[model samples]
Target: MYSTHLSPMQTYLVSENLKKMVSEDWRREKLHSNIAYFKTKMKNANRTVMPSGSAIQPIWIGDEKVALSVSEQLKQKGIWLTAIRYPTVAKGAARLRLTLTTDHTHDDIDFLVKSLVECTYD
Candidate 1:
């Protein structure tokens, strides 16, 4: 997964817009809320760490619709999805490893996690 570190200036810009531009403020507020939601979900997801330096977010592929949809969406957004399959991952240990980046908004990550959960559960 990718690492995200917000620079002070960037944080200030967002905070300022939250106080200035109405549209930008709304977007920023939504993103912040979404990030909080996703972070909570991730903490509960019981992700696994593989020997290959990859992180496996506890996703059950027996239900593929949610995960697949999220993966496709991520690929479309230039976020690569590295799926661990049967041959590559041990039995009953498949998952989606998302590499996060600084370029990604918190909203992007939230949407992704939400999409995965929706697809897997539905």
Candidate 2:
């Protein structure tokens, strides 16, 4: 028995569009490449890039106060990043989480890296 269900139209649309979605392999490769680029650039800017097994990379910013400050600054620059702390992560591990998506372009990644560096310094 099905525990969940989708309407007939939903099922048909999902089936038809499944192949159009980004492939798992492509997403993995792109995520790794972007993470590597950010790691290097952020390190140069004195920011920490927390290692992760998935596309979500947490950039430690010392504490919640700093994380929030950085998040707001980045937001002002048109970059929306979430600040993670407390219940989400341990105290003193406050960070800004960056998620890489298949829809993001290399230039987009570059802009993020540049913006991050600028924001941290400013």
Candidate 3:
């Protein structure tokens, strides 16, 4: 029912972008580049981002209270990082999810890293 009955507009959009979505050029240029950019920025900031080969990198906060507090702080700063908690992870293993995309520029990443550092230290 999902793929079998996409609306006409949905079909049009997907068909139009399908080639780019699966293209090697897109992956090598956009996806891989953004991932590298984000990881490098995080590492340079000395933030503990778990090694993830994809767009979503997890920064472990370990304590649920700290994770939730940081999540709120980032939210107030206009960044939306969800605090992952127990049941999703073992107790004492909370984290903040950092997602990067081709739409994000280096400046954006820099500001995010700065904000993160500030939020954690404040």
Q: What TM-score, computed on C-alpha atoms, does each candidate reach?
A: 0.41, 0.70, 0.78
lDDT of 1 by residue, 1-122 (tens): 44335789999998896576555555556545554444566656643223232222334453344446656665775667755545555665556665443345666776666555444233
lDDT of each: 0.53, 0.77, 0.83
Tell me how far candidate 2 lies from the true structure as C-alpha RMSD in angstroms: 6.5
Model 3 Cα lDDT, one tens digit per residue, 43-107: 88888888798778899788999999999999999999999988778899989988787788888
Ranking by lDDT: 3, 2, 1
Q: Could you tell which candidate, 1 or 2, scores higher by lDDT?
A: 2
- Clash pairs, model 3 backbone: none
| Superior by TM-score: candidate 2 or candidate 3 | 3
Candidate 1 clashes: the total is 3
Sliding window of 10 residues with minimal summed lDDT for model 2? 19-28
Local lDDT at 88 for model 1: 52
- Judged by lDDT relative to the true structure, which candidate is superior, 1 or 3? 3
Which residue pairs come into collision in candidate 1?
A: 2-99, 2-100, 66-119
RMSD per model, one decimal: 10.7, 6.5, 5.4
